[model samples]
Target: MSTRFSIEKLGAQGDGVAQTETGQVFIPFTLSGEVVTAARERNHDRATLMAVLEKSPLRIEPACRHFGDCGGCAMQHLEEAAYRDWKRDRLVQVLKGARIECEVDELVACAPHSRRRVTLSARRTDAGLLLGFNRHMSTQIVDLDECPIALPQIAGALDMLRELGSLICATSKAFHMTVTVTASGLDVAASGSGRMGERQRQIAANFAVRHGVARLSVDGEIIIEPQKPVVMFEAAAVPIPPGSFLQATQGAEQIMADLVGQHLARAKKVTDLFAGCGSFALRLAKKSEVHAVEGEAPALAALDRGFRYASGLKRVTTEKRDLFRRPLTFKELNAFDGLVFDPPRAGAQDQCRQIARSDVPLVAAVSCNPVTFARDLAILLAGGYRLIRVVPIDQFLWSPHVEAVALLEKPRKRR
Candidate 1:
């Protein structure tokens, strides 16, 4: 027997919620107020999109052929505007749950098809080389013939590389590829002992050569290297490597960096934690002294380069420290009057705790996950910090992810 239910709220993982007579069931590809026929026997607790008996106004056709199976995109079925609204609503709910009161500005949304970087998994299967994202909630690999979000040129390369991987056999399991687009050309790196063999490298070389690519690197060696690095963000061209972290959208990164500059206007001695390639530090130096800290050594090297090339009155310093294990001490924290934290989705809970216990007067936290940000906000509030403002910045487009910057001020002393 199947029980019917209506979706009441959207869950954190982009699943629609329905209150069944027995319990709540989460069905994918459904929107709020969507009354769809769901098979409630998949996970023994009643979870399945049996049929879309009724479609909500918010429903839309997903453009990607591998939408349901590919794990990279979950909300492709949702209309673009509706998807942004849902994500903004979720952020509001999270802030309320954490007792942080603030107004939510218009949610910024990135373009649907502006992804310049993509990481695909390769597996040796009986059929051949299966190159694609893992299937949702399973280890199954979904073969993606074409990706709607990736750049056209990279997408073509993906198709060609898939065949090349299959032919080499040595490239089957050991191959991992990251495709990045620079202003000059596309950059790809295939790594693993047997992965990206001589034949695969030759294929990449020929593809770049025929396409008139400016740069190409395989297995730590440059085949068609450029004389200078290609700039992704303003005045700064990141010589991105095989495994470096970069914003997927070049246009969106410029906007994000601009927002960072605005947020650091009044900052004096600023500390940028989890600073990658000095994205915030170099720019922040135009307005204030910046101390950049990051865990990755290569990123630190890039940050140093950015600092050296930076032209201005403000000073810049670099520190390679792992905040996860060894956060800044009170004495260390006292050097900075303000801090700009751009942590990963994990959020910097331990570092937040440390900052809350310090005397820093101003803070600007850039976050990708609202839940973790709320958790960290609670700690800051407990330490006498008042929520100032929250600005949503859209970095990842067409996906459920939302990036936001929250400003906090220390409370006045009671005399």
Candidate 2:
């Protein structure tokens, strides 16, 4: 079935929404104020855009030809300013919904082809090796001839990666191939490629060396290490663990570090919660003594090593603790003058409650999900902490996801 509808607004997922008398219909690749003809999906709430009868003025040429089908980017077709506004508005809208009041800064932009890390799906297909990102909401992989969003070093090596992928591919089932650009070279990690025998592992190792790969890890174990793969967090050189969490882009990481660092500059001691491999901890150690906490032992070890090897830095320490299971109590949190937490998408509901009760003079929060960020902000606000400012960062670029750094300050009680 086909129908013509006017796009009412952009949804959270960058899908153009049209409100029918029944409910809202989500149409992808369509923009607000545009009249589009769409084929009705069996799901009823989703529609496939057949054609745009009227196009929005904000529409712009997408940088990549794979825009719609690739699933890596969503708002690439929208104009630059509008795209940024949408990202910033994501924070503002969520804050209001959470009943928290604060001024959200404009979106800090990131350049195209700047993504330092990307996880590509790979498998041995009858049509040769299929290596690329999965289709939008589908298991199907979109084999890439080129990726404009990835660094040139990564995009240009697509063919080479395919050949390398072929070497370790023991089964036809699709697997993840995470490639990260580091100071030494490309660090490639593969998982779920099926069990590999000694011969298959040797072939993969040889291919990694010939192609100048920094390191190659399979199923969470290092198969070959040609060079020590490290990423510089400000002046400190930190080793990135295999399949560790890294801010999607180097540019975005710098922006976040600056935001968190500048806000907590006055504190002599800072505790970084949910810290992964000392992204902000080491940088803060340049000024304040940092206690980095994370659940992953490998990441904590790497952070400890980075701190030990770095020169001209204040004391830096690491604690391997599962924050979710047993968050630092309010009494424990009072030990730190300043605290910064960058939790995963679920946000830090449990941790924020403790921070809220604590007398930490300054707090900086970095989160990828606005909804959860707002929820946690509400918790902090309820506990006498005043919201300062929130800055949205476009690290995911054209994707609907937005990252934010929020500052909060607790007023001292006078005697």
Candidate 3:
């Protein structure tokens, strides 16, 4: 049945929320203060937006034609000022919910078309290979003619990548290709495609060379390497692993590194937990001795190499250990005067508990998820650490994801 709803606010997932007689209803692609008519699904409070009887003043035209249909972005319809405020408010709300109160800095804006890394889905169709993002709430792929969120080099090569997918695709099933635009050139990595024969492998290699791709890999195995894919972390040039994790944009990474470096500047020794390719450790080593701990061996090796070749840097050591399995204990953490940790979405709960018990004076906590970040901050707060401030970074522009760097300090008791 159709129902009338006045959107009250946007939920954490970027859906519009309405307080109805029955309960709160969530409608996709809606804005606050808009009167929307939607049809409720059977046995569910969530509704599908049918019409916007009244539009919000904060609503604006989306940049991409695939805004609503493509699942890549949700808040493109919101105006710039309102959108940034909303993103920053999300981090504040999460911190309040966790009962960890602190001042939050204004949102750090990342420009569109700044994304260097993108993962696209591809499948063999009757006509040819289809490539793009999956449609909203469906498994169907939306073939892209253009994507405003991706770097121009990546967006312009959509059709060429689709053609490359056809050659690499050994089965009728769908696969994923991660394209990263590095300093050398494009690094394409394909996975979930069936094994290729020698002839097919030869064709793939030829396609990569002819198209000027820096490197190509299938299921983590390197197929062709015309040039090394090197990504600079500050002064260090680190060779990136295929399909490895990197900050969405270089601007956001610099902001995060600056915040982290500023917090740990005075310390003589620092430990970076969950360090991936030495993003923070390389920059931190400018002032302090750094020990980087990571689970991925390849990433740790890259960090070690970057440290050795880079000149005028302090001592940098790496340890390959899964922090989730073996979090550094209080005694181990006590060796470092400063610490910085940037864990994945599943935030470092076990590690935070140990840090809380330790006496590290200066600490910088970086996170991609605000919820888990807030939870971890609460632990540190309970251990008497005073939060200096939290800065929210919008690296994934027009998307729900937000990155943050939080600084904290704990004073030592006098004897």
Q: What would the TM-scores of all predictions be?
A: 0.86, 0.98, 0.97
Measured on C-alpha atoms, candidate 1 has an lDDT of 0.74
Model 1 lDDT tens row, 266-368: 7788999998877677767778988999999878787777666645547878899999899887568877788888888899999998998877788888888
Better of 2 and 3 by TM-score: 2
Worst 10 residues of 1 by lDDT: 226-235
Supply candidate 3's per-residue lDDT for 221. Answer: 97
Cα distance off (Å), candidate 3, residue 381: 1.0
Candidate structures ordered by TM-score, highest first: 2, 3, 1
Cα deviation at 121, candidate 2, in Å, is 1.2
- The global C-alpha lDDT for each of the candidates, from Candidate 1 onward, is 0.74, 0.91, 0.92
lDDT by residue (tens digit), candidate 2, 25-131 = 99988999999999878889998888999999999988988888888888998999999998888888989998887788889998989999999999888889989
Show pairs that collide, candidate 1: 40-46, 231-237
